[model samples]
Target: MTIILAWYRDLIELTMSSNLMTMVQPGAFSNLIQIGVLNLRLNNLTTIKSDSNSITNIQSGAILNLPKMRELNLQSNQITDIRPGTFSNLPNLPRLRLSSNHITNIWPGAFSSLPQLRWLDMCSNQLTYIQADAFSNLPQLSYLNLASNQIATIPPDTFLDLPQLMKLVLLNNPWQCDCRMVAFSLSSAEMLTNTIK
Candidate 1:
């Protein structure tokens, strides 16, 4: 994936690097803080290495920098999990794209840092399990795309704090819309109805 992919026409530091850890580090992207956007989409970023040289599947502390970063593009990768505080430093980040990955699980408090985030695209993944209130930190989130996944059921109170949520795309999933999901169905219907207005 190409890091520091800016929003304008010109790209920065275009390279074919495979290892996500060795990207101008052990400095850890300290020079990319001035850029407005970063597009690391479409690559073989399979693992992210911690400061102590420990190997892991999720890229957390490795990307905690970039205070001015607004949009981040990580679409189409091999990420299967999201640990907590992976993005705690980027509080101003608004849009995050994570579509078409292999993410099956997102730990609780994983996105607690994104308070100003607006759009989150987690569509077309292998997500089957998400902890309750996993998205509680996103107080200003508007659009959420969870379409085309293995989601069989969404636990109640999952989206309780998302009052400003505009669109929720849950199409093409194996939803067990039974009585146990009364609250989920009702809230989803209400969210949609509110969106129409």
Candidate 2:
């Protein structure tokens, strides 16, 4: 605990001085609502927060107070689960990176608050299932990368709300090219066409 506390305190000093922010925990910056960019990449973190750490564990409504946070990087962690609406507090968040994790499922409304989200990277994950309308909240989303995942099928209306999507990457997945898939592929093509033209 002392080591973690020292690390957390160092992060605050570095961030306040406008130097570089890394290896920092979310609870460490919970009170800094207007922080512009936060990067916690390659931290080997498994959970969003832990209750034992008094200085950095997120309290209730602590995340919601961060109304001005824009970019967050949590890539290369051991994160496996994302509680629904956990990210729904950052309505102004634009860029989010969750690549190279063990995420296998995405709960519905997981990104509901990120109305300004532009880029979302979930590559190199174990994602095999995504709840319906899981991405419906990100209406302004543009770039999405789901490459190197375990996705076998894409459900209907999975991307209905991503009207502003510019680039989509779904490569390297074991797609089950069956009847439903054929139909889904055709429908996806149509949807893309409609979105483009």
Tens digits of per-residue lDDT, candidate 1, 147-197, equal 999998887768767877877888999988788689777877776676678
For candidate 1, report its TM-score: 0.80
Best candidate (score: lDDT): 1
| Clash totals, every prediction | 0, 0
Cand. 2 Cα-lDDT: 0.67
Model 2: which ten-residue window has the lowest total lDDT?
50-59
When summed lDDT is taken over every stretch of 10 residues in candidate 1, the lowest stretch is 48-57
Compared to the true structure, candidate 2 yields what TM-score?
Answer: 0.80
